[model samples]
Each structure stands twice: as structure tokens, then as C-alpha cells.
Target: MSERYEYQPHRLLRQRVRDIPSGAEGVLMAVITEDVSPNGIPHWVDLAYIRNKSGREFTTAVGNIEPA
Candidate 1:
């Protein structure tokens, strides 16, 4: 007998943060953004949050991604 299954979509967000002093080779801290998928359904990125060393935070539609 064959088994049937349901397909569900999902959204994933990955975040990493590090604290660097005058000189460092590795990151101090890393934080991964929580998954915002509801009902375990598939979803797409709508927005994102990012902060820089200057302590300036900003938000934008999910599209731009690069190493800081």
C-alpha cells in the first residue's frame, strides 16, 4: 500500500552577530532569527532587520544580503 502525505511551505531566517574589539579573528556572539512560519506553512520573506556597529538599525524587504 502507498501512503499519502501533505506538502507544506516554509520560511527560514538565519542571523549571525559577533562582537569584535580592536582586533579579533572570530565572532563573539551569533543570533539566529526566529522562524516566522505560522501553522508550519510555507511562506516568503516580507521584511528583515539589521544593525551595524554604529548601533544603527534598519528594516527592508527581504532582498539585500551581504557580510558586514
Candidate 2:
């Protein structure tokens, strides 16, 4: 099972894919599911809210950051 759509302050987000820089790390705050239209079809996307090392909080699609 995966972490649900809730705040997990201790969860770490490390960049392993090209969407984010390698070795970059952050705190995963929450994972929210939203209905999105990428190409017209409604798709549920997991948006990971994170706080970077510099304390800047941002959200990105889940795959760009992995749990560490």
C-alpha cells in the first residue's frame, strides 16, 4: 500500500527522475488526488506537496519525487 492523501511531514522526497534534479531532497507533506485532463480524458493524478531544503513548498506530479 502507498501513503494516502494526508500530511506526512516526515516523509522524504528525493529526485530520481529528470523532472527534478538528481540528489535533490524535500519533505513530502501530502498526496492529493485530483481529476485532471491531460489530453481530454479525466485522469486521477497524485500531486505531491513538498517542502524543499530551502523551505520553499511546491507541488508536483508524484513520479518526479520518490519516497526516501
Candidate 3:
């Protein structure tokens, strides 16, 4: 089952980087902008408007995010 997340605008979140090889664990911090779930399951989020600690922003799947 997919986990449910309650996200609010501007809320800081920690996202895991699973796409990277080498099994190098990495976490990215970002602020929530809006829910981008296409099936209305809150499974995706838009972070393009928020930047990370390095001032980088992106949109990713909700499975990558966790409470910061």
C-alpha cells in the first residue's frame, strides 16, 4: 500500500535520492509547493517553486519525500 502524506505549502521536506547508482545514500531538502498527483492519491509533489539548501529546485515523486 502507498503511504499517505500530509504536505503543506512552504513546508520543508527531506527527499531520498534513489535514482543515483553506487547505492550512495543521499537526501535533498526542499519546500513543498503543491500536490502533483495525477490520480489524486497524493503520490507526487511539485517542488519546482522551492529551492534546496543549494538553491536547486525540482519536482519529484512523493515516495521520495519524508518529514524534515
| Candidate number of the best TM-score | 2
TM-score of 2: 0.48
lDDT of 1 by residue, 1-68 (tens): 02122222213233432222222122112223334467766444433444545655544433333333
Question: Which portions of model 2 show Cα errors greater than 4 Å?
Answer: 1-23, 37-43
Q: For residues 1-68, what per-residue lDDT tens digits would candidate 3 score against the true structure?
A: 24443345433335544322232333554444464567876654444222345655555543444433
lDDT of every model, 2 decimals: 0.35, 0.59, 0.44
Our model 1 lands, by Cα RMSD against the true structure, at 11.9
Candidate 1 regions off by >4 Å? 1-45
The candidate 3 region of ten consecutive residues with least summed lDDT is: 17-26
Cα lDDT for residue 52, model 1?
A: 49
Please report the TM-score between candidate 3 and the true structure. Answer: 0.27
Q: Give the lDDT of residue 2 in candidate 3.
A: 44
**What pairs collide in candidate 3?**
none
Clash count, candidate 1: 3
In the range 1-68, model 2's lDDT, one tens digit per residue, is: 23323333324534322226454557776667766655855566678777776887777777777655
